[model samples]
Target: MSSSKLARMAHVCVLALAALSWGAKTVTYDFNVTWVTANPDGLLERKVVGINGQWPLPVIEVDKGDRLVVNVHNGLGDRGCSIHFHGMFQNGTNEMDGPSMVTQCPILPGSSMTYNFTVNQNGTYWYHCHTDYCYPDGYRQALIVHDSDAYFAHDYDEEFTITVSDWYHELVEDLSTEFMSLYNPTGAEPIPSSFLLNDTINTSIPVKPNSTYLFRLINHGAFVGQYFYIEDHSFEIVEIDGVYTEPTEADMLYISVAQRYAILLKTKDTIDKNYAIVTVADSTLLDKIPSDLQLNNTNWLEYNKNAPHPQAIVNVSDSTDLHPYDDLSLVPYDHMPLLPEPDLEINVTVYMKNLMTGYNYAFLNNITYTAPKVPTLYTVMSSGDLADNPEIYGDFTHSVVLNHNDVVQLVLNNGDTGSHPFHLHGHQFQVIDRSPPYGPGFYDYLNGDPVPYDPNNHTAFPRTPARRDTVVLPPHGYFVIRFVADNPGVWVFHCHIDWHLSSGLAMLMIEAPRQIQERVTIPQEHYDVCRAAGVAFEGNAAANTKDFLDLSGQRSQPGWIPDGFTVHGIVALAFSVLSAICGILSIVIYGMADVKNKQDSVVPLDNPNEVVVEQNATGQTKT
Candidate 1:
C-alpha cells in the first residue's frame, strides 16, 4: 500500500483510540449576559450582548455523547434573553430546547435559567438568543460537535469555524419599531449597514501549504443570505446543518440565515501567494442596497506573512450571477431512504398583508402567530389528557399536534414576493421537492401568483434526499419536506428572518404531547424565571385553568382590514371632507366681503365703466 493510505489508516486508528480514552463528560458554562461595546465592521461602535463581559461570544465545543450545561444570568437589566441550541434534537430533554414562549419563558432582567442536555448528534450547529428581536445585537456564536467517527474526519489536518453575518448599526429594538409600523407598509426588511466575517472585517486566517483543512461556515445573520467562495480554490461539501452528506465538489455555496455548511479544502502545493476568501451578500433579498454598504467582503487565507494579500476581484454584475452548486442534489452519507407515505400532511401558504392598523404582517394560511399567555410547553405539561387537543394551545399560535412516530409531510407555498428560510427546531428533515430550482430560474414566479404544489404533478422525489434543519423557500414558489415525529417536543417551524418572524411568520408543532409529559420535566429554575417574569406556568393558552376551552382573554393579532372601506376609515374620510368644505367656504366669504367694501368706497363717473378714487389735498382733477 502507498504511504498516504497508511498514514490515513494510522490517523483513523489514533482518533478511535482517543475517542475511547475520552469518554462522555459533563461540560458546564457560567454565562453572565451583559451589554458591551463592539465595532466589528470598523465603521460604527454600538452596544451588543456579551457573555462574561466579552463580545464575540465564545464558541461552544464538545464531543458526541457529552452532557452540556449552560447557566445563564440576564444582566442587561432591560432586555430578556434565552439561548436556543440551533440544531439539537433535544429528545427526552424537551424543556432544554429553548425558544421564548414555545418551550420556556424568557429569562427576564435579573432572572436566571439553566439549559442542560446531552449532545447525541454530531456535526456543525450554533447557539443564539431565541428571545424576540434579541440575537441581532451580537448574541450568537457557533456550537461545534466533534465526532471522531465521522466519515471524513481522517481526511483533514485541522479545522476552522467562520461565521458570516449582516450587521446593523442600530439595535433590533429600535429597528423593530419602524419595521412593524404603518410607514413600512410593504414589510420591507431593514437593510444591513455592513457584512461581517468572523464578527470582524479585513482579517486573515493562517494556513500551511499542501494541507487539508475543514472549514465550517455559518450564516448567523438576521435577514440576508450570502454567497461564499474561496478565490482560486474548490472545496468538497461534507456536512450541512448537522447532517453528514456524501462529498460533493463545489466552488461556491449560498448559505441562508441560520444555515451551516462544512467543506474540506486542500491547500495548494506552493506557499508563494495568499488567496482571498469572499462572501457576497444576496442583493436579490435586499429591498434597496446602500451605496456605502459594502455588499462583498474579502478575508485572506495567509500562506506567508511576507506575501502581499490582496482584495478579491468580483466578476459578477449581481450575486445571482454566481451560480452556486444546488444543495438539493446532495445525498446523505448514511443514505436514509425516503420516508413512507405521510401519516399527516400540512399545506400552508405564506402571505404578507396589511392589517387594520395599516402595518404589514406575515401569515400562514390567514393565521398570524401570536404568543399565548402561558408557554405552550407548560400548557401541554399542565393539561392532562387534553394535551392531545390542538385547540387548547390557542388559535393564534397556529398549533398542530402530532402523533408519536408519525411521518409528517409539510408543504410550504410562498405567496409573498420574497425568499424565506424556514427552520424546524427539533429535527432535520428530508427535502423532497422544490420548484424553480436554485439556478437562473429561481425568480420565475415573482411577477405572477404563487404556484402551490400538486402532488400528482411534480418532479420525481429523490430516493435518498438531503437532510437539513433549515431550507429556503423560493419567491412565489414552494418546497416539500418530510420527517418522522419521533422526538417529542414543542418544536417551532418559522422563517429565519428576524423581521419576518417578528411579523408573525411562525407556527408551533406539538409533537407527541402525551409522550412529552411522560418523559420531560421542567426544572424549578424555569418555573422561577417564569414567575419572576409574570408569566403563567399552568392553565390553557389564556391562563384559564378552570376551562381549557375558554380562550376569552387570549392574545391575538391585529384585526384584518375589510375588503373595502372600514368603519374607522369611513369616519376619518368624512371628517377630512367636512374640514376641507369649511375652509373653502371661509375663503369665498372673505373674497366677497373685500369686493363689497371696494364698491362702497369707489365714486362712480358718468360713464358706467369708469370709477373715481379719493381726491388729493391740492384739488387737481383726480379721476
Candidate 2:
C-alpha cells in the first residue's frame, strides 16, 4: 500500500473508535450538611438540615453516563447522617449506595465521606438522607439525569424541576420522638402547617406564549400525597418515576410521596392572563390532620411577567384524589417486554398495632423493621451469616436473602388504616396488578369472589406492566410487583413517608448474598467508617480480620468547625473504584487502603463530642 493510503486508513480507524466511546463525564459535588433554622413557608423558624447552607439543597443536573461523586460532610451536631440516591440501580458499586445501617455506617459528625457512583441511565430522581428523621428536616434535593433519547422533545422548548412538599412548623426532632413514643395517646402523625412548591408557599413560574415547557415534577414531601394542576392548562404526562411513558393527558394528577413526573406544558395564546397552580393535599388516606392547618395552596403559571401575581381562582378539588392512577394504561418505553413468572413470591402484609411498649407503629409481616446496630453489609460480608443464619439478624432487621438470578415477586396486602408510598432501591420493578378497594366498589362479588393477589392466578396482570421504583399501596388493598434478583447487594424496600420509615416500616432485600460475598470485596474504608461511627461489624461469629486501622503516627488532638463548615479528621477517608465506566478522585485520604490493627482504639465514638483522636502518616494513632 502507498504511504498516503495507509495514513488515511489509520485516520478512519481512529474516528470509528472515537464514535464508540464518547459519553463518559464525571460530575463532582461538595455538599456540606448542617443544622440551620430556615422557614421555607415564611411562617415559623424551625431548625432544618440544609446542604451547603441552603434549605432545599442544590438541584443536581447531569447528562447520562456521567459519574456522580459527592462528598457529604455532616456538620450536624451529634447527628449521624446517610444519603440514598432514590432510584439508581447501583450496579457493581453497592458500597456507594447510601442506606444507613444497610450499605454502610453513617457518616459521622464532623467527618466527610465520598459517594462515587455512575448514572448510566437517565430520568428524574431525588436524593435524601436515609437516616432517622433527617429528610423531614429539609435534607432533600432534586436529581435530574438527561439523555438524548427523549421522545417528547417536540412538545417542550425548555425544562424546569418543581418540587412539592408538605411543610410543618415544628422541627422533626421535636415531633418524631412523641410520634414514636410509648406514652402518646392520640397516635396521630404530626400534620403539616402548609404545602409548598419548590420550598415556598407562593411559586410563580413565568412562561412565554406559544411555547412548550417540560416541567419535571417531584413530590418531596413526607406525610401527604398532593394533587396539582393549572387552572387553564391541560398537560400531557410524558414520564413517570424517571421512565418515559407514552404521552397521556390528564386534567389533574395525584402524586405520591417521592414520585416524579415529566409533564409537557403547552402554553396557550391567553396573553396577559395568569393561571392558578392549584396544589392541594389529598388527605383522604389519613383520618387525622390538624384541623387548624391549611392544606390548599396556590402557585402561579404566568404568561406575562409584569402581571401581578393572582390568587387561586380554581377550587381545591379532590377529583383525581381517589387513588393513584392505573399503570396498565401507561406504557414504558424500555423494559422487560413481558412479565416473567416469579420464581419466588413473598406475601408482605402491612399492619397497624400497638407494640409491647404501647407505641403505635406500622408493621410489615407483623414485624416493624428496625435499624440494625451494625451495617448489614459488613455483617453479611464478615460473618458470612446472612445466608447460613438469617435468623441471627432477627425480625426487626427483616433481612431477606435471595439466591442469584431468582425472579422475585412481592404481594403487598395492606392491613393498615392508611395508605403508604413504597419505594425500592437498586432497580425499578413492574407493577403487575392491584385490586380495587372492594372489588371495584360494585356488586362484583355477586358474580365471583373478590380475588386479589392470588399467586395461583395467571391472568391477573395486564399484558404490558408499569415500571417504576415507587408505588402507592392503598389501605385495605393489595399491590403486586415483580423484579429479578440481579444486583447483588443489600437494598432497601420501604415506605417513602418519613414518619413511616422512622416507625420502622422498612425491609432489606439482600439479593444474591452468596454471589455478593464471592464477587464483591468489602473495602477497608467501609470498615473504617464503622470504626469511626463506633459500630461493630462482626457481632456473634468470630472473623479473621484486623480490629482497627492505625494509619501512621499519632497527632495531638481532634479539630472541628461549627455550623456548615468542613472538617478533616481520621475518618476523612475517600476511595476510588477504577472501572471502565468512571473513576473517583481520591483526595488526601490517609490509611484508606492499607489495614492494620489499632492497639488502644476505643469502641467507635458513639458520641460526636468525644475527644478527637489523630493519627500520623507512620501508621500510629493517638488521642
Best by TM-score: 1
Angstrom error of the Cα, residue 560, model 2: value is 44
Candidate 1 wrongly placed segments (more than 4 Å): 1-22, 565-623
**Candidate that scores best on lDDT:** 1
Q: In model 2, which runs have C-alpha deviations exceeding 4 angstroms?
A: 1-21, 313-325, 384-389, 437-452, 456-459, 518-523, 539-623
Q: 560-582, model 2: which lDDT tens digit per residue?
A: 22344222211121112233124
Please give, for residues 56-111, the per-residue lDDT of candidate 1 as tens digits.
99999999999999999999999899999999999999899889998999999999
Model 2 scores a C-alpha lDDT of 0.74
Q: On a 0 to 100 scale, what is the lDDT of residue 186 in model 2?
A: 35
TM-score of each: 0.89, 0.80
The stretch of ten residues in a row with the least summed lDDT in candidate 1 is: 566-575
Report, for all candidates in order, the number of backbone clashes: 0, 9
